[model samples]
Target: MTDKQVLPKVTKITAQKRQGRYNVFLDDHYAFPISEDVMIKFRIFKGMEIDDQLQAKILAADDVSKAYTRALAFLSGHLRTEKEIKQKLQENEIPETTIEATLKKLRGLNLVNDLQYAGSYVRTMARTSDKGPIVIRRNLRAKGVLENDIDEGLREYPEEQQVENGVEIAEKLSHRYRRDPVSKMKQKVRQGLMTKGFSGDVITQILAKTHFEMNPELEDEKLQNEFTKVWHRNRRYPFMQRKLRTKRTLYSKGFQSDDINRLLDQQVDSQ
Candidate 1:
C-alpha cells in the first residue's frame, strides 16, 4: 500500500448565515465541510474517508448557474412575479429542492418579489391606460402571483379611486368623440372607459362628473366636431360611411344599453 496524506486546499473560507443556515464558501463557491470529529470517526471506522473541495465547488457552480440563468430569463422580459419566476425555473427542468433553495436566495436578495411587481405593474398600467382592479388582478393571476400578494399590493389605493381614474381616461377620449351629439359623445366616452376594465359603477360615477371644455353643452355642434376629429385621425374607413358605423364602434367602447339607445336616437334625429 502506498502511504499518502490528503489535505484540504483551504482555498478561501468565508462564513455567513443564509436563510438561517451556516453557508460556507470556498474560492467564491459552495464548500461542504464536515466536522473534524465526524471526519475522524469515518477515517477510523470506514477504512478511509475522502473529502474533496473541488467536487463541492463543481456542485455549487451548477446550482449557482441554474439560479442565475433563471433570474436572467425572468428579467429579460417584463418584471415577473416571484411565482412566475419559480414556475419558469421549474418548467426549465430544475429540481424542486433546487427551485426552493434558489427562490429563497432570490428572496433574500430582494430580486424576486410578487408584491413589488404587482404594485409596479398596476401603477404603470393605471398611468398609461384606464385598466381597473379586475383587469389588473386577472393579469397578475395569469402570471401565477398569489391573490394575497395582489390584494395587498393594491390595498393601499382606495377602490373608489378607480372611478377617478375612469374619469381621467374618459377625458382623454373626449377630444376624439366630442363632435358627436352630446348623447353619442357621452355614450362613446362611457364605453371607452368601461372597456379599459373600469367597473360599471365607477364608469357611471365618473361619466356623471366628466365634461369636455371645448364642448360646454355637448350638443350636436360638439358631437360633429369630435366625430370629425376621430374620423380624420384614422382614415381607415371611408369618411362618407364612418358615422353609419359608429354605433357598433361605440358599443365596442363599452356603452350601456340606455346610453346606446339615446345616442342612436339622437344621431337619427340629427340625420
Candidate 2:
C-alpha cells in the first residue's frame, strides 16, 4: 500500500526445541518466534497472510501469553489471589497492559479467586499457625483482599476455637512468668494474649479458668537471685540507703513484702 511495505508472508512455521514455543518464518526469512498459546490464539500457520497490523497484534498477544505462563508458574506452589498474581507480574517487570490481559486469562480460567483464597487462608492459619482471628484478618487485608471476603473468611474461624487457643496460649505464658507473682503473671499473660490477637473476652475466660501456681522453692530461689543482685549493686551507697534500695527493688519485682523483709534482714545481719 505504502512505499514502506510490511515485511511478512508467513512462509513457514516450525517447532522449537523449547516446549510450548515455535519459530515462524516470513518471506522465507527468519521472523519472530511465538508461544504455542499465541499460535493457537491466532491460528498462525504456514502461508497465512499477515499484514503489519496482524503482526503487531500477534506480538502483543504473545506478550500476554508469556506473562500468563509466568503467572501460572507463580501459582504452581499454592493458590493465590488476583492481587498476588498482579504483584508477581509486577515484580518480574511485566508491562501493565500485558499484566491486565494475563489476569483476564487467569480469571477466565477460574485460577485466581480472592474469596476462595481468603477462606482457605483463614482455615489453614487458624488450624496450623498460632495466628488468631484479628491477626489473620490483618494479614488478608494486607494482601489486598476485600473486606467482605475477609469477613467471609473469618466465618470459618469459630469463637470456640478462639477460646481454646487463647487458653492454651495463656497457660504457656503463665509458665514462662512463673517466677513472678500470680497477679503479675496474669498481667503478663494478658499482655501476651493481646499481642497475639486474642479478644479481650477470650483472655478474660482464660484468666478465670487457668490457675498459675509457682512452686514455693522456685519463688524462694528467684527471691535469692534478685536479693543478691540488688544488694551487691547498691553496696556503694550507705548501709541504710542500701537496705532501703534493695527492699524497694525486690518489692517492685513482684516479691512478697514479708519475703523481701526477711531476705533484707538476713543480708543486713550478714554485713
Candidate 3:
C-alpha cells in the first residue's frame, strides 16, 4: 500500500489552555499541537486525512507558527529590535530556518520594523529617562539596530532639548544640596548630569543655566545649627580644640573654608 493510502485520519481536535492553540489527534492518538494560524493556514480539522508527507508539512508549519507566536508575545509589551527577536528565538531553541520564516512573516505584516522601534525607543527615553543621545545610540546599537536608524532616532532629540532636560534634572538636585557651598553644589550637579549621559557641552550649558546662588541667610542658619550640634558633641575639648574640630566638621559638610572660619569666629565672639 502507498504511504498516502495508509495515512492516519485525524479523530479529534482539542483546544489547549494556551490561547489560539489546539491539539490534533490522529486515529484517536495525540499527534501534535498547532497554533491557530497554522491550523487555518493548513486547513486542519478533525476527520482530515494526513498523509506522511502532509504530516511532515504540518509539523514544519507548526514550528514556524510557534516561533511567530512567540515573537508576537515578545513584541506585545514592548518594541523589539530584529537582533533582539533573533536572540529570543534562538534562546528558545527554534531552528534557524523557522526563525527566518517567522521573522519574514513579521516583516511582511510590518510589525518588526527597526526604524519604527528605534524612533519609539528614543522618544520614550527622552521623555522618561535621563539618557543622552550618545548613550541612547550605544544602547540602540547593542539591541541590533543599524547606525542609520539610530541616527534617525537620535535626530528627534535635539541638543537644545538635551540641555533643557539636563537643566531640569540639575534644578531638582539643587533642592537637596541647598546648604552646600556653590562649588560643591555645581560639582554635584555636573557629576549627576554626566551619569545621566549628558555630554560635557550639555552639562556646561545646563550648569550655566542653573547657576547656584548662595543664600547667606540660609547658609548662616544651617551653619549655626550644625555648629551647635558640633559644639555639644565636642564639649569635652578646650575652646581652641573645639573650634578646630567644628571647622573641620563644617568643611566636611561642604561649607567653604571662609564660611567655616566666619561661623567659628562668631561662636567665639558670642561665648
Model 3's lDDT to the true fold?
Answer: 0.86
Q: Which stretches of candidate 3 lie over 4 Å from their true place?
A: 1-54, 83-97, 134-148, 211-213, 226-253, 263-271
Q: What digit string (tens of lDDT, one per residue) describes model 2 on residues 1-61?
A: 6697555678888888989998889999888989998899899988787887898999999
Report lDDT (CA) for all predictions. 0.63, 0.87, 0.86
lDDT of 3 by residue, 1-271 (tens): 6564567999999999988889999999998888898899899877788998998899998999889889999999888889999999999999999999999999999989999999999999999998888789889989999999988998789899999888888988887777776667788888888777888988888888995778888777877787789878987888888888888887877777887787677665233
Candidate 1 residue pairs that clash = 179-222, 179-223, 179-224, 179-225, 179-226, 180-223, 191-253, 191-254
Off by over 4 Å in 2: 1-7, 235-244, 258-271
The model with the greater TM-score, 1 or 2, is 2
Best by TM-score: 2
Worst 10 residues of 2 by lDDT: 262-271
State residue 51's C-alpha deviation in candidate 1, in Å: 5.7
What does candidate 3 score on TM? 0.71
Which ten-residue region of model 3 has the weakest summed lDDT? 262-271
TM-score of each model, in listed order: 0.55, 0.84, 0.71
For model 3 the local lDDT of residue 37 reads: 83
